[model samples]
Target: MNASDRTPADLLRSALAADPARPLVTFYDDATGERVELSVATFANWVAKTANLLQGDLAAAPGDRLALLLPAHWQSAVWLLAASSVGVTVEVGGDPADADLVVSGPDTLEAARACSGERVALALRPLGGRFPQPPAGFADYAVEVPGQGDRFAPYAPVDPDAPALAVGGLELTGVQLVGRARADAAELGLAPGSRLLSGRAYDSWDGLSAGLFAPLVAGGSVVLCRNLGELSQEGLDKRVESERVTNTAV
Candidate 1:
């Protein structure tokens, strides 16, 4: 099958169809200081709604760029999928001015987008705590309103062969990523309903796809450390014990 024929959304959708009430992501953002989670069904709706909101709010044209400052993980996953579904390019900013649209993360959004200078037309950022105090000109992505549509339609049918990501200027195909994620899940031994503890950064491709998306799609549990970079062994131990998590091969 072609790359467009498969995607993380496919796996997520399957899981939601099987059981929408199940939690697809569980994590605490260090910047937000709030523990949040989204059940499979809620996540699906969130993705669709976000797609509609992004499309409407940004007026993103087909193949337009939406630079993502958010790291990879559960929350990032939904945004990535939503952006893809709506035909907006998901650009993880490695260099400033590399994107047409720029959205910054709690820690790095401001500096990251600063590289863009005046190149970026639309800047979407979350509000509240560390929501990057933009210097004069920038819009809050979180403030963007979700459109009236209850669902989203693909702006253009995504070809599995189309580049899903850019790494140092090289395009990575969507199908390749899906395959890699699946393979990693199998190698890690994750299956439906498995419990996982990750004190790792989801910014990396491997970590985001395998550590977060893989387990969630497989009907598993994901426990993320809010301070992943500073996570202590003791903290992970406590989380395991308190949560009654059973370790598996994955």
Candidate 2:
């Protein structure tokens, strides 16, 4: 695919077609002693299922705003790509009440309830297990998403010029997002096959770029660390060595 005509979804599709077996996201939660690795095909499967859930069940339309109230975990990454594939606008940490749908973690239960639209709650448990019981007003993501289709086709074509993401006071179209990510990947010295270890939170431009978009654009992968403060320098070093990380962003 030509770079000028590419979107984030296009990048992901290319990666899947090029090397479906390559590791796409490696997640670590130091506090919980959790480590999970998802290959490109596995990650794409999750994205497709979630995208189908959004489109088929939730009835999310292009340009619809989805409030993402979650941390920098693997599931959060899945939702990001799912929303992008369906041409939904992701508002990271946005006010749930104003969004067309809300996807939240246990920590944001209250805020998620305040949202009048459809709601999905992730347990964020190890292995992405289902919640003990469904959260009051929301569907359990683990319970619902798995039953959705494994392939996704948006109801309408995703416009490259449509708004795709809004975070940290920046609103970006699909093309702009991919272009910026490509530029940022070059600036960060990311090359194909690079593995980037990022302990930074996804609350700002720097963190999001390094932790997600840049890696996708550069045909690299990310080792995303949540609760990074819980790991000592020695632990971090060991993780970097074990994961064979080629770059670091914190």
Candidate 3:
């Protein structure tokens, strides 16, 4: 991570300053045969729009709790950074009823309705498509997010020392989260411009670090694969080669 970076949003800004045109995330869903790549600028644009949706539409404030009930897809990555930018605490796979707001994927929409607060749903379709019918009691993320502003400025500044993530029974401040991400990036042998291929779920700290934060802090990109077990060795090898992956955390 950059020495000047405090929050995850700061890290993203540092990366954007470094190279906005370079690919920051390459996502593939073996089960659906889908592939998508986003440069730093493109990824940050999505983050900005999503952050606007969270802060403006959902009326989320700093310290608000967000239950993220999504998988390790590109949209999930967008939501993570967006929540961080909004200064909202994110709880991965958290209980809906305990959250001030819940963001869920198609598979978890029914369960996400337990949240009495605001709810957002992602269809997880290719190219970030919307659901045919909006789920009841939940805003369609793909639909609402696009209409949001391209740029975002948090009404309230995020506190680096404030809680930013709650996962695996552990709570971490933004500073601590960045510290851990830097450490994980080192342990995973990531370097500037490195591409790390990860085929892990986003339910645990390890998976989260590998799939998202580590690469972010390392000034590298991620090849995030979902349902990777379904891919043949030949296919996986081809993907690794095509994505120019230098490290693996599958």
Which candidate tops TM-score? 3
Query: Candidate 1's residue-wise lDDT over 1-250, tens digit each?
Result: 1223366556666776778887766665545455667777777887887677667665665566666666544556667777666656666655556665665655564665554432222221222222334334555444443333667776667666666665435455666666776676666677777766665555566556555655754567666655554545695567678755654321
- Residue 105 alpha-carbon offset, candidate 3, angstroms: 0.7
**Stretches of candidate 3 above 4 Å error?**
none
- Model 1 is weakest, by summed lDDT over 10 consecutive residues, at 119-128
Better of 1 and 2 by lDDT: 2
Which of 1 and 3 is ahead in lDDT? 3
Q: Judge candidate 3 at residue 31 and give its lDDT.
A: 94
TM-score per model over all chains: 0.78, 0.98, 0.99
- Candidate 1 backbone clash number: 7
Backbone clash pairs for candidate 2 read none
Residue range 63-150, candidate 2, lDDT tens digits: 8999999989999889888998999999999999899999999999998887899999999999999999888889999999888888
Question: How many steric overlaps are in each model, in order?
Answer: 7, 0, 0
| Model 3 Cα lDDT, one tens digit per residue, 88-112 | 9999999999999999999988889
